[model samples]
Target: MSSNPDNGPAVSRREFDELFEAVRTWGRWPAPGRGAWNRVTADHVRAAASLVRTGTVVPIGRPWDTRPGPDNTRPALHHMSDLGDVEPPEPSAYKDFLGADYHGKSVTHLDALSHLAYRGLLYDGRDARGSVGAGGARFGSVQELGPLVTRGVLLDLPAVLGVDWLEPGRAVHAADVTAAERALGVTLGDGDAVLLRSGRFRRRRELGPWDCGAASAGWHVDAVPLLGERGVCLLGADGDSDVRPSPVEGVHSPVHTLAITAMGVPLLDNLDLEALSAACAGAGRYAFLLVATPLNVPGGTGSPVNPVAVM
Candidate 1:
């Protein structure tokens, strides 16, 4: 195993495969397409609703970026489709168009079960090639998992550690998760959505943008088993939820492989958590009601999302 100063030792392929088998939740639910989202029952929604005390809502999606940057190679598309200058019979309409290749590092998006494959297999052992076609995914498309409402626990690492932001390439391990839980006065529960805040955007805003795909502060492989054991249905972060250069030697995105392909958990990527961090600190609570409604796009691997946290 290789070791880095910031992220500790890299996990071997054999070790990662073993961990994958340990956390694999294939066939655990009746609906194979919905995956871990099946754990969020109606009761869970009601419990999440109960956490909305002040009704302060914070949107977690970043602005639709149209400019090219080191991090955003494929910038989102936004243009005036209809302007008032158009030939108007009575009243002119002003409209705009929005499009994105959202599966990258820039857009805030939800990754469905079909988004990733491990060794040519998707969640629940669905063969990647056989399940996903040129058009879109057939087995575990975004349509299968509809609107998601659940209790969200924010593990604000910077706030807990008394820092502005954890520098890029730092690894958040399993022990750090427990420490953050204790520090934030919250506990992980079944069907809960966990959002890890490494203060990524804050760092970018203060220090300028960097290529997060090359290096970022996020979960180490050691944290997956704890989340799996806690029965977490959703996982998200300011980054794409994997520390880089990856802790797994051969794998580029080990957390994604373990969480989505193995544990069948959906991931929220590139969330703007600065506002939520302040709001949670102000409210003196880390737990809140989370409502993430992805676009109902049939056969889509994932959807660009603007999730809201209501406190």
Candidate 2:
């Protein structure tokens, strides 16, 4: 695709609006409410619940390692502590706040909205509604992602391909999931939380944790709606979840940004995938309803979730 040079034509504001209007009219999906929207919503919800309730739940993510940024030294650490006084408190209290950047190991975490922003927008188009954005803070964040309980299905790619790590920019299609289900004799239920294990997580035990801030792996865009139709409310993976590189190049993370961000569902990535995978393989059964809830951090973009399997 050639870049539009300065010589290219420009459209007036009116023309732009006209173009938008035409597109909207030409390709508008009829939301259910216009005709039995309630029934439609109910059907989707039931399907989602059915799929997730019967599938196995595997939490697939890594621990959020906190290290120092340039502004991450001792003095700067005061910000995360939020001490009442401007200056550091007495020596006794100093140690209490020094470790915000080094939480060590903890269970159950949900990424705060402040940790990420979509095209400068927050979850549920909160920014478009003129709401404050996720500023990497977790207190009093986001609305409930609706009660999250469903069948969780795990697609073990490493187990499938007989490799240790999937190559970067790997493409996973709906057919792959279908094949896995057929081989495993498990059909997904509605609202199933599919936990994808790409085997990249095995490195933690092999190489130790990598440097913080590297991007994680994710599924392809084409897989989103297919899962959506099956009533998937959340998709959990072992990688960072979003495949689009930061300052994403002419693309969007439609899987989450469009699916959960706009459609009011949620996605969990960066979880502990290896342990969960081992548990399922040992059980020899891939059917179980999965359940997990992030701390109710209102106005938060996400919460760290230490999900458990209700097998």
Candidate 3:
């Protein structure tokens, strides 16, 4: 996918038709509410027996696995506080000692609102220019995504690509997201969280901290408006969600990252794709998803997630 509208835009009538049809079949559809996050339980999925036409949804997000791995660069870990006196059993045990970096990685983590900011204020409207971006832009933490527990949908693009890596700088447009839903024969809801798989996390772990993406995997900024229109609150991907190319002349993050943050959404990055994607492909279904929030640790940019999706 390329933003070069010169190569032509990504949308197609056939893709849209399939998407529209899938939604039309989803019974008892509800309009998205203010927060737009609702957990999906097995019973609720079974209840949607009314909507099943054919096929299943594959788990399309990445799983976070840690070793004595590298950390993501986002301040907080600048000092590179030394490894603790005691050696932990598993990488996870060292999370807290990871200081702000955590296990040298923040894989499978939820993106906090504090990760980005517009000119001055954060989502909650406090002058971060006066304080830390980690504030709730309020009396406490600046992020509001801690409350996000929504119906998440996985779009397994790499499975369809028959390749491990989705080329870097390639665009995974709004239409491809929809095309995937059609391929799975599922309709997306207004509030659904979209977790994308570009197979970037399969990259070498030796890249050290802040290193992610396999050969190449990233999305385009052009998809933001449509995501906003769809009211998507979270965008989780195996790689960076927005179209920020490394070595850009002058920018911390890509424009879409800033634009989406301005819209008050969080971007979960560097997910593991092996087991999850395989399970979904084997199940031939995309129903049944769960994420526990009791896992959140405030004042951090991201956290590891072991989110499970059932068929």
Candidate 4:
């Protein structure tokens, strides 16, 4: 295994290939699409619904970032589409427009199975070219994983470690995941959405923003095996879910490849988990009802989302 230039954990090409094969779920699900989301059965949603006692709903999505920076390169555009000043016949009216390239550092977005490809194939060994193209995805698009609702487990690593935030380039391991679960008195189960909090936004607010795409604290490759074993349907984090200055050689986003392409699990990226963390801590619980519905764009790979956690 060759180490990344930033001195992150290194997984050799052969090791990555082996890992991919080990966790592959190709043709495992009975249905053709939806992938791991198929695990979220009616029972799972009912159980998750039971957790909403206080009826406290917290939005975990970051605000629409419109400023230009290393993180928000494709800043979201918001402009007044209709100003009532044009014609004041009777009542005043106002309207606005919003647009963004949300698949980046600054926006909270969900990644469908079509977002990643390995060896010219998507999840279920479908040909990337045939399933995905200029129009959108034909196979595992956002439409396939409709309205993800299930139990959400928050692994607040920063809170567990008693730190404001993990430093950049810090790679969270499988051990950390277990430790956080123990510390938070929660257990992950089948069809659960696991959200790892590295306190990236807290650090940025306190110490100023940096190029998260260049270096960020997130899951290393070693953590995926345990998550797969625990049957986590969705994975998310304050960062893009991959430790930047990627650990695997020749692969910039190993977590993305393994989670989406190999295991067929969707990913939630750039979530604002600060408030959710506080709410969980106050409630003395880490699990909640996670409700997220992606925009139903036909053939689209993924969509910008505003996911909510109800305690």
In terms of TM-score, the best-performing candidate is 1
- In order of appearance, the predictions have TM-scores of 0.99, 0.61, 0.63, 0.97
TM-score of 3: 0.63
Query: Poorest 10 consecutive residues of model 3 by lDDT?
Result: 25-34
lDDT of 3 by residue, 45-80 (tens): 445443334334334343333333333443233233
lDDT of each: 0.94, 0.48, 0.48, 0.92
Query: After superposing candidate 3, which stretches have Cα over 4 Å from the reference?
Result: 1-106, 124-126, 131-144, 203-215, 244-249, 255-260, 292-302
**Clash totals for all models, in order?**
0, 44, 19, 0
Rank candidates, TM-score, best first.
1, 4, 3, 2
**Which residue pairs show backbone clashes in model 1?**
none
| Candidate 1 residue lDDT tens string, 1-311 | 77788976789999999999999999899998999999999999999999999999999989988889988999999999888887869698999999999999999999999999999999999999999999999988899998989999999999999999999899999999999989999999999999999999999999999999999999999999999999999999999999988989789999999999998899999999999999999999999999999999999999999999999
Looking at model 4, residue 82 earns an lDDT score of 82
Q: Write the per-residue lDDT of candidate 2 for residues 186-265, one digit (tens) a residue.
A: 77655566777776557555755443233334565445556656655456676645442322233435445444433334
254: Cα error in model 1, Å = 0.4
Worst 10 residues of 1 by lDDT: 81-90
